[model samples]
Target: MTTTYRVTLRNRNGVPLDVAEDEPIYAAALRAGIQLPIACNYGGCITCAAKLITGHVRQPKGTALNRRQSQAGFILLCVARPTCDCVLDVGVESHRGLYQNPFAIAGNRYPPDA
Candidate 1:
């Protein structure tokens, strides 16, 4: 039997998307006809930045998030595949001002100080 985990992703409006563990969060959202903030699907852009509120994910090595950001629970939905059930907060509003750098906040550029 194949095992699959549930992933719940939320936006600023408290909207939630149910994603699959083996799929990228963005792709799951797209498959469900949900429009999420995304630029590059390769994890170069921070447009798809999200916070991992619960559970775990296997993020691509190319993800723009730094060690600090990763430790702080940041994940790139475009390249993040859930390793288990997960809950992610999407968009800058979801960050609640934890990150100050526009690039880091936006998930596009990595801050040197980070």
Candidate 2:
């Protein structure tokens, strides 16, 4: 049987994507072009941390996570799976300044089809 999950995220831009029962949330986001920030794909890193505003998550087997963080509503999407309809508060405040930069990125001038 196939497992389908309901994922509601922070903003309209943060549309939820589909994830297979066994697939990692990070992998699912990547497949859907969500560009979720992640460094180590393993639980060793907290770069992909997101807040589960609602619902439950099932972590991978043998993974280690701090109970305090869990209680505080933090989740590492790189290794998390929803056990019910979920809403996540993504994009941490630490990275908010980056989004405010208007001149930070200079896109390619040449046309890709040229």
Best by lDDT: 1
Top candidate when judged by TM-score against the true structure: 1
Writing each residue's lDDT as its tens digit, candidate 1 over 37-108 gives 788888886778788889988877545876767777878888888787777787676555346656545764
Q: For model 1, what is the alpha-carbon lDDT of residue 60?
A: 71
Candidate 2 at 91: error in angstroms?
2.3
| Residue 9 C-alpha lDDT in model 2 | 66
Question: How high is each candidate's TM-score?
Answer: 0.72, 0.71
- Per-residue lDDT tens digits of candidate 2, residues 48-110? 777777888877741434554555667788888877778877766423221223253346322
- How does candidate 1 score on lDDT? 0.72
- Where is the poorest 10-residue window by lDDT in model 2? 93-102
